[model samples]
Target: MTEAFIPIFYFSGTGNTWWVGNQIAEELQERGCQAQPISIEQVTDDEAHELIEKAAMVGIGYPIYGSDAPLIMQAFIENLPAVTGQKPMFIYVTQAAWSGDGAYFMRKLIEAKGYQIRWAVHFNMPNNINADLGWIITMILKLFQAKLPHAAERAAKLAQHIVDNQPWIMGKSSFLSFGWTQRFFFRKGFDSSHKNIWSVDAEKCTSCGRCVRLCPVDNITLVDGLPQFGDQCNICLRCYNYCPELAILAYKRPYNPQMFGTQPYQGPVSEFKPEMLIEKK
Candidate 1:
């Protein structure tokens, strides 16, 4: 019999989801299962289908945005081919705080595609959005550090459950689902108008084009050596958070890098780089 292997398709803006997904993958590997964490942005449609078709189980991970999965992840799920024979799948989400029904939202989407969900979990990490806050950021970082081991242990247990075929479904509730529905509609409306919300500070911008390279959706481009925003932005905050010069500004509150001199969160992994998410040709 062939050994079970799982592929975790994940999207991370500032690295929290990527870190968590890798931890889970590592734990799965330690338990004698083959697993790998693949960035959703770097995956091609044909590659995704092949991975899903050959895997014993599938996993999806992403950061929770506005109590739901990011737009890119939602599109990935929507584009997935429905599985035959009810393939086993699991979901995990990373968030700074309460995610409401974020995992449940993904569960419903995947279940609709004929995958039997075996696990759904969330991990609270440092707040990437509010990285500019002074003492608050420090406090959150401390909390994240304290919770790191617990989160990793939980991930290990999740792997063990998968290896043992034990089901552990989380973040599902009628009450939370109701709230999620309202938030989802509001988020969709806000996202539609968010294209023009980002502006580049030409003075601070170094014309390095890092934002253009880091953008998952190709929503940014260089015009006259300056980055320009487009209508397809999923608002992953990658360009904003990963900008070396802190030049990218969002119209939303808490995104004022100029006024706040916001410190960008470089993700949990110290060696992480923006170029790592870029697909290599």
Candidate 2:
């Protein structure tokens, strides 16, 4: 008999969603199912279509941006080829503070493509955006670190349920799901225009081309040994977090101040690998 294969498609900026997708993949494997975690940005449309076609189930994951789905994820969802019958699907969204309607929006997208949504889960992780909170940053890191065990366990259990074809539900918070008005406003106002907010410091940049390589959208180019931003950035902050020189700036006031540099999530998920998860008997 052919074994069931599950594919998890993730859009990660600073590796948060990648980590979550890996965790779920790990659990699915432990249950004797074949699962693979693939980064959406790393695959071409044809490759993505191939992955989806081979899978018996699908998993979609991403980090919430501007209280909604990141632009890249939206584009990926739109590009997916429709299925003949409904494919069982699950959604997982990670956010620093609030996911708003991010998971809801993604659920709708998946269902629109003839996928049956088995469940949608929201995870609150450390914010990747380097806010100038000083001492609060320490507190935030500590809190996220403390939540790792619970989050991993939740991910594993959810994946197990999917593997067993069992039903599970998460009573997500209502307050976190922002209204349509807010979603429309933020999606149009912030996410659509975020690419313009990034800037490169000519004095600080070493022309190492880290930002250029890290850009998921190919929205960066090197001109005269300095990185220049384009109009397609998804605000994933990969360049900001991965920059060794802290030269890339978001130019959004307190949200991206120069004083605070390279504030990426250093939580257990970021620090640990998926193989570290133990399959509970």
Q: Model 2: residues >4 Å from true position, as ranges?
A: 131-146, 169-181, 191-195, 252-281
Model 1 lDDT per residue over 1-281, tens place = 12678989998888888888899999888888889899977888789999999998999998876787777888889998889899998899887776667776756667788899888887877667643445665565446432567778879988888888888867677666664765667687776767667887788889998889888888999999999888888777788888878788766323454633456667776887767766653
TM-scores for the candidates: 0.87, 0.82
Each model's RMSD to truth, in Å? 3.4, 5.5
Estimate every model's Cα lDDT from 0 to 1.
0.78, 0.71
Give lDDT tens digits, candidate 2, residues 183-260.
778767775567668787788889998678767778999999999888888877777766777677666333343444
- The true-structure Cα RMSD of candidate 1 reads 3.4
Error of 2 at 12 (Å): 0.5
The weakest ten consecutive residues by lDDT in model 1 span 252-261
